[model samples]
Target: MKNRNQSKKPKFIVISEQIISKIISGELLPGEKVPSENELIHNFQVSNTTARKSLQEIESRGYAQRIKGKGTFVLNKTEDHHLVRTLGSIDATRRGFDEGLKVEGFKPKTIVLEKTVLDHGVSAEISGKSYIIEGPVLKVHQLRYADEMLLKDETKYISLKLCPKINMLSTDLSYFKVYEDKYQLKISDIKQNLSAIILPPDDPTNNFEYESALPVFVLDSVVLSRKDAVLELEKSLYRGDKYKFAIIAHPEYNGN
Candidate 1:
């Protein structure tokens, strides 16, 4: 009976869960080596395949990372930061990255790297809707730092038709704030898509100074003004090693 019950769940999953529990309980410290496959096989009396899968499972869940030729190690939990941007909300979407970092107790700084006016404008597709931002788009490239740590690299294309002479404004200021305060444009919607990407070493835009290829989160966003007019398009890269994103969800109808 006990054997029959044990067979219901995969042995590798059980082992991985135990390891995860250890991590959650603080038994495994950051940068500490995780158990080797041989150790897991010996300890659990499992086959090599099961042991390998167990480690892979832990790494997939982001609790551990594998270092080539060395072994897997726990990631730093204390420094792992999360950006809590609520989805489908105007106010939350308007909260600037600098403000978010400051709320998290980190001093934030913005550095403008490049700015140019593209007379031909740009094309973008958001939420299955196509947009052709009319000529004379202002492209702003910048880097965001949190407490002296490079956290984000971003490029924003603002429609000059909607925000003329916006390129004259300081790039260090938040575009969202500028759209609302200076232009009096109501930012009604913001659509975002997030995905994991490997930062290529040869990519010119890659500013990370890691010896190995870095993992990053790519955020593509479209900011819309009143009447669903596309105001801006943004492509931002975040350090995957240091940051995570959270979305707040609530029931549509409360059963009060």
Candidate 2:
């Protein structure tokens, strides 16, 4: 269970903490049954509404979910991942992803964003190679829009060995989809580093427009699998105006 010291917060918050604790403690594995509403009420000395509300909070926080007749069940929440973090097979409809990609430009070519490969002090478990992924990280530049306005300019890196087809990709395709559907790889985890920098190769804005903009947001991450295999290390610059990120913590099972 997550070791959270007790605090005199709202009852629902306290209950939520306990639920998180249990998941961390391993008492509640993914798909495990949570206490029924009646059990929760009796155990917590709370009302039915409060119990339900606690469950809702858990769900909203990305921890648990309620099935039609099956009661509340633990969800398999992903460890927050980043750097073109595949909002993996999301409920796109709800998130407005159904809005569709306005492909302003899709080009696959060699971009040397990083000049040299210094040891990142990390090793891949799958291959146990000392270097980042066998070759230079190929940066795929993408400019997409949901509507008329500029959406995001993406510079994603793919290891040459893991993604040889990337060199031949003629048009824009969902990078994650291609990896999963064609390559049979699943992005199980991601670690990200986000910072603000004066936008360089990523933004479409010319020097004239620079006066009105804030610094760009840079995201660097190495994606991995459940087996600790480093899939790819990616570095991307996002148009600070067009991209926003949200993170929520929930109880989840991490592919044990």
Candidate 3:
């Protein structure tokens, strides 16, 4: 049982949520200066650490960006550069990246940075389900681009039991096609979770060159075959400024 009277959220989170609501409501525009630590401390009557953490929380969620000497500012959202990607019904088959981008008149490309075969199995939890991929899995690190613009930095873990000798395939081709065409595996469904995150400045896996922290969409995905056999696990970082996801919603009816 949980305590009903206690506050569930921390002070920093509360402050950050308020600021984010302002941003969403157009009270704060892109490139506009955000409240500094001192301003937040004075306005909220909170400590310096709490104020700083609040700002950090906002930036981490892709709502704001900080300058070295200057104060933090709202991240610029360019409608022209944003590519709208529609997410269909959950049971509908997913489209390949190449096909989706091509339909939008953009040339898609994948550049493999590294590939390795692991000795032990990889374990992951997706959509409340736990899965352990057997040993001899293939690990691939790659960058995905649209025309000349970088869009995604992706890492994939593939079960060799389902895709044996997949390391020998051309890294440039789409794995989704290879799974169905070459391996004769029927992909049943894909499970994914998306969240806004900031890539650390010093992270070695970060291939993007940016002066400040980079805001991205971290997409965790699990690919399944017929009968719920796990085929692959992927962690992909999509550039927040370049991509926008659109999903359709239907209202549920409760009989009156």
Candidate 4:
């Protein structure tokens, strides 16, 4: 006979996992009513105590909010979906700076408003390399629009040393495309840092047209080539209210 003390699956845990799976799969969206304790007890044929414990577990884990009489509801996804975005593939659908905004019904438009061919030394400083940059080095300032609303402002330092005539490319085109398709440059890696800041109302350098009191997300990144050469330095600001980031973590699995 099997040991009576041997571990057995908790019925409540199984039911909780079922509901969480639905939430993660987007079938149960934020603010939707989750099945109540009574419902779970009736549907799963489990004890009322087991069902109640499961609902408490969900609320304690930040997946749902239990009002005294209003019942349990799913919490906002922003809390559950925030990602570290350290070194890995970010979800393409949630990236703020690209055409992926189309998933949210917003058309992306990048407008290059200024270009300056900086002195060779200035280019070196921005690109983190010696003055061996090929072709012409220029800085381009751009404004990004989503559905005609100013959503992002960007400043890019590009090295045309490897691919001459890159400056002549259209402003709205993706530079990643230019590097891969036009110059056939293999991207080796990218490093990024992110921060949050509130734009001061009196700050003239803040070109984005939004309330100064609102916080914005800033991203600073460097793109590298196959030989570990710095290809570009990008600084961009995104409207915080318009974007969400996601990340996946493995706590037990270690890759060697």
- Higher-scoring candidate on lDDT, 1 or 4: 1
Model 1 has a clash total of 0
Of the pair 3 and 4, which is ahead by TM-score? 3
Report the lDDT tens digits of candidate 2 across residue range 1-256.
Answer: 2334444567887887788789667566544557777888999999998888888888787767676675776664435211122322232211222122211111223222223222223332222334255454455555544334433445555665566656566434555566666777777765666667775443564321344555567666666554665656655555565554544356798999
How do all models score by TM-score? 0.64, 0.44, 0.61, 0.58
| Candidate 3 global lDDT | 0.77
Which lDDT values do the candidates have, in the order given?
Answer: 0.79, 0.53, 0.77, 0.66
Model 1: residues >4 Å from true position, as ranges?
Answer: 1-78, 87-89, 249-256
What TM-score would candidate 1 get against the native?
0.64
Model 4 RMSD in angstroms? 11.7
lDDT, ranked from best to worst = 1, 3, 4, 2
Local error of candidate 2 at residue 237 (angstroms): 2.3
- Point out the higher-scoring one by TM-score: 1 or 3: 1
Clashing pairs in 1: none
- Which candidate, 1 or 2, has the higher lDDT? 1
Please report the candidate that would top lDDT against the real structure: 1
lDDT of 3 by residue, 156-256 (tens): 89989899999888776668878888899998877777789888768786777666788888877788898988898888888887877666666898987
Q: What digit string (tens of lDDT, one per residue) describes model 1 on residues 63-91? A: 88776775787755565554434445565
Which of the numbered candidates is closest to the native, going by highest TM-score? Answer: 1
For model 1, what is the alpha-carbon lDDT of residue 95?
53
